[model samples]
Target: MNFLRRVFEHGRFGFVLLLFVLMVSTLGWKIVDLHVFDHDFLQGQGDARSVRHIPIPAHRGVITDRNGEPLAVSTPVTAIWGNGRELQAVRDQWPVLAEALGQKPGRLSERLEQAANREFIYLARGLTPEHGQQVLDLNIPGVNALEEFRRFYPAGEVAAHVVGFTDIDDKGREGMELAFDQWLAGVPGERQVLKDRRGRVIKDVQVLSNAKPGGELELSIDLRLQYLAHRELRNSLLEFGAKAGSLVMIDVRTGEILAMVNQPVYNPNNRRVLQPGVTRNRAMIDVFEPGSTVKPFTIAAALATGKWRPESVVDTTPGWMRIGRYTIRDVSRGGQLDLTGILMKSSNIGISKIALDIGAEPLYSMMHSAGFGQSTGLGFPGERVGVLPNHRVWKEAEIAALGYGYGLSVTAVQLAHAFATLGNDGKSVPLSLIRRDRAQEGHQVMEAEIAHQVLRMLRAVVEEPGGGGSRAKVPGYHVGGKSGTAKKVSTSGGYTDDAYRSFFAGLAPLNNPRIAAVVVIDEPSKGGYYGGLVAAPVFGRVMAGALRLMNIAPDNLPVETKTAAVVPGKGGRS
Candidate 1:
């Protein structure tokens, strides 16, 4: 009993000890629960923190011209990327790292903040390799360089319309780049990367994405001819005080487009300096009244149907024919002229009369067969099928005027191709802007004999004294063609007072012709506005150039055979 009493006296110390023991036991139970009972949950949380993601880039394809000239290419560049966790842990050396990278401390602070919040972020894009190496020498925690592609145009402005340009992401934005974006942009590949506790790269377990290189694209444009045509067209546009100009050269035998050029051109490489009109491809997109250039088709149609012969006389004594409310007048008061003289003078009366004889049926058929009123099938974009009112839309006066190159629209290419029909022995083939080295099948409209005769008459049109197209005469080559001028369309109605479309379509070496060309001047208000004055000289230069290039030998034949060659294949065309 006495010992129990003594132990009771020390009960305060025992009570304090008991309370401390209970507090320690409660804390131990909680630590056990967190470390053992919920071990899987804590492990999952730790694993989420240790995981990291990285990006892999795909390489785009290269673009080359027909002769393997590089239009666009991809080059290697460096990207500055940072690791958020590592940079946060090594915050002490940040000022030194910023000084080495030539950046202010505040800017780096913002970058660090972004890295902490965002798993992946670019500190810099499209930096040069040298710049990247300088950044790497700092050995800044969490910051490194990445590989990327930067687009480049080697030709610069040489072939901008063909090669196209790309955005900063290496995506095709314009021209063939946009047209063939699918082939140029390859499938992107990806991989999953692993990191240790300190965020250092450890091991790569699996690849989630496969890398692919873009496919190649080859163009049919000849770089040399394209450059030549662009140079000449620019000179002409500047010299003539004209708004713009376009020229196209076609191979008579193969239908390959040797050259196509338009002024107000833009270099695809320097797109920022270009206007919308500069990028327009007028050779295919713009359609205008081809003036007297269209007369050959009517003359050919008249001769082919046996309705009118080249020697056949027509009463164009008055030089004007009044029909309904419209009066059709020739360029001059030509006396009674045979088909040959009428064409030489570009008489509206003679062509109108011939159109009446042949009727709307044959005229429409000839134009359609000549590849007018339809697309050229050149395999490029931005081409228009020129507007030609159907025969069903033809009224008496309208149809007659259409015969003289009015009330309808056609592309310069189509007009050149129509004359090519006569030069090609009355066969109409599809016009090709691309380089085609194979045999192309053509559709025959007029027989070879009739086409031969028509060629002769066109030669007479150029060879005759005081002829409108005398400027088209080429040395060492017999050339024949027609000249035409039409008042341009106005916003109000009828024709604009001063605006005109001057045009000429010609074939060289009248005997066994080889090449054909067309020249057009839009709104040419220069000193000489006539097609004979403004457009024929252009034809002469281009025709002579083409003849020399093709090595077409001259025909030393007498004027008789040359004249007879103009005869219509079926009728007395020449």
Candidate 2:
């Protein structure tokens, strides 16, 4: 009996031992299968949990003025973002993170709830890098800060209309920023990195791609002139109680815009104040009747026809004339005035007779050649090309209106361009907003002799006694320009009775014109609403400063006897 019991115990032990050996052998086989046969698969699964491919942001390009001064620039900034799925695990840290972001806990909670299903989301943007780093130092899982760029305009509102501003993502939204967006946006790069259990980058594994920065844009804006124009226009709007105003100055020799400014300007840096009405660049996009500013071109047309000269006489017997049903009246009696006198007096009757005699085709051809009815090719978005009538047959009233600067519309820039054409001795060059090392090639639009004559005649409007634009005279400079006031078209159709647009268009140093400018005051409610009263002074002051800044010798310096102060040299010469 004892021997049988011992044999059974021995059999039970052998069975248990066999089972243990089988288990050990199977475990060893499985270990070898994973570590050797499926090595790549195992490693990939491990990497999938902690390795990340992240984006490396590239900086945007810079924008400079013609003189190499920084107008718009991109400054390094930071943005806080997160992976919603991973952030959910650290939900308890919501209040702490909210505090760091300067946001309420409830607000942060609501934002998280809205983005619960999103893999990636932005928590805050446009934060300083130091603030962003503090948030990242919290080491909360799934929370990260990315490097970004914010546009900074050094010139601020002074250059807001021309340089424009960008969006939160550094995307160009308006003005020159939008116009040159593609050339100013940068390309992002990709990098592979390894993260720890807390989701913090532990190592940079590899760089998959390199970032490429955007190109620079240099505009022809002279900042000094821009500031001068801005100050004068802003002050004028306040002084005249005008609804809005625009001033445009061009380098006649090069067709380069030296200065362009508008009233009601908003600071591009302040996003909250970016309303559509205030941001509109009225100088380029708004159009109005040229008024008497167009009289110079009309006289140029008459001169081109060989029928009128600077001394040609026009019969203005009663200072009023009837064409069809419309009676054209002068502001004052302009009886028996010459061609120059008609322009100086801004006579509606005398100009009407001249238009009737020379006909509309010649005037249209002349104005069109001077760039009155076409785009300035400035490539600005929403720029309007002013209206100039094109008709097979014209009514006598239309012809008469066209002669005295009516039945037509022009932008302030376009008006400046036309005057610049006259200043360029009838040569029409393409208008440019970008800087050019030299003057652009141009085509002759009118005879140099004719343009010179018209320029000389325009001088009488400012220099001669009893001239309409006497207020436009710049001290110590030979100033020449015309003043105009036209009734604004009402919203319900015909012209408004009370509202009017005042204008002044002219050039300085009349013999060797360097710059031409146009100023427009819209709906001046206070002070005098006449062009001579409101707009001419702005042109005079701005032009005077521009000429002095440019170091152009004054052509109309006061005459005096030989004296120490009178002589330009150290000692008076014989």
TM per candidate comes to 0.75, 0.90
- Give the per-residue lDDT digits (tens) of candidate 1, residues 17-71: 9999999999998889879897887777876787556667778888875567777
| Number of clashing pairs per prediction, in order | 20, 0
Residue range 1-574, candidate 2, lDDT tens digits:
9999999999999999999999999999888988999888789999999999988877788898888999888888889988887888889999999999999999998888888887678999989999999999998888987788888898989989888888897888889999989888878899999988756788999999998898898898789999999999989999999999999989999999998899889888786847788888999999999899999889989999998888999989797888878888999897899989998899888888899999989989998888888998998978999899978999989999998888998899999999999999899988888988889898888899999998888999998988888888998888889999999999999899999999999999897999999999999999889998899999999999999988999988778877444477666656
lDDT of each: 0.76, 0.90
Residue 411 lDDT (model 2): 92
Worst 10 residues of 1 by lDDT: 556-565
Highest TM-score against the true fold, candidate: 2
Q: Best candidate per lDDT, number?
A: 2
- The deviation in Å at residue 216 for candidate 1 is 4.3
